[model samples]
Target: MKNKLFLSLALFFCATNIMLSQNIEIKDDKVLVDGKEILKYEKINFFQHSFYSLTDDEEILMYKYNDNESREYKEDDYFILNFLTAKKKIECGDIQKVVTGLGMSSKKNMEKLITWLLKEKVIDVNGILNTNKLDTFYEKYNENITERTIR
Candidate 1:
């Protein structure tokens, strides 16, 4: 009975890890998944200074993942979401940090987030998530004030 329990537990862990695993890479100012570009970036020049403009969405995603009070997803999950939904450019390595209980968020809060997105029509009922729809959803709901909005 004990051996059966241990085997079951091992299989569960392996399956969970497989489900959450993602290959995240940044190349040539683009965020890539499995060598396919998922996001692109353009360098910003400010007179003598030049830098990339990071998006509010990117920052908030990291905040939600790193803040102990709100931390409920793995970095990879946050990374993909940010890449898909952010209107502004982001550097993948900018917010990387040591995370405890890395995959702990996979089951609960992650599911809740997905469910809410689906209900809001941000995500479709299809098995595969549509990245363009994700972007549209973020743009529709994001609350960052812009100069155009002020007028």
Candidate 2:
């Protein structure tokens, strides 16, 4: 019984480490997955949730196990570690932090850019999430904000 317990515990740690090693990492103004450049992302606030009447949706969906299908946020490290993990999405100046963290240039305010993108219909009211439009937008404009490194 003791040997079985020890083996089980060891397996658990190894499994957890493997899972965490694949968690999203942002470095040098790029989002990396398994050491490759992946789509840029932003933590979002779907509602105000500040007053008694405000409602906020802080959760997001991400790829599950390298498959196209995604479930709701569950043990997703991206959401779990950010302040958006709070009962409501972050507010005010802090929201900017999320944008900057996602490789957005601080010089460019998201509200104005997002408004223009929405006006152009590059993104919808739901926000410019993990879609190809966002990927293309980043591909086109990211060079202006972040210095490209020759590989």
Candidate 3:
């Protein structure tokens, strides 16, 4: 009976560790994995590491517009605007300007718009803004202009 109980407890601990490893939370500029806040030194390094891992060239290609399909840039514009507003916590006004600068006019064409920007060399892989920055909003609430998307 004691051996069975010990085995059950070990299994429970292993399952708990697996669950804790998958999700990350941000609050007050601190990163939490499971319930514990990661140390400051680890936080920045971890963020940088994750950021580098997420952004890649192929992901950028997926958002490009295909003119042969008659896709409009507006669709992409609105998509980007909404994404930026939600992810960066930026004002709608600011997002509009950024979207316009990218030649995107509609939310529906966001995919194509982003692709065009990348193809035109207007926005490089590192230059394109990332919407996932919203994940860190609870911590810093600061807008990051340099964030890029990851596939």
TM-score of every candidate: 0.32, 0.25, 0.18
Q: Give the per-residue lDDT digits (tens) of candidate 1, residues 52-109.
A: 2233212212213322223564332222234333444222222222122435332233
For model 3, how does the per-residue alpha-carbon lDDT over 1-151 read when each residue is reduced to its tens digit?
9999999999999999877443333344333434454311112231011111123322221111112222454332212122222333321212333233444433323323333333444333434443343343223332332254232
Clashing pairs in 2: none
Residue 111 lDDT in candidate 1: 34
What local distance difference test score does each model get?
A: 0.38, 0.34, 0.33
What residue pairs are clashing in model 1? none
On the 0 to 100 scale, the lDDT of residue 85 in model 2 is: 23
Clashes of each: 0, 0, 19
Specify the poorest-scoring 10-residue window by lDDT in model 1. 44-53
* Clash number for candidate 3: 19
RMSD (CA, Å), candidate 3 to true, equals: 17.7
Superposed Cα deviation of residue 102, candidate 3 (Å): 43
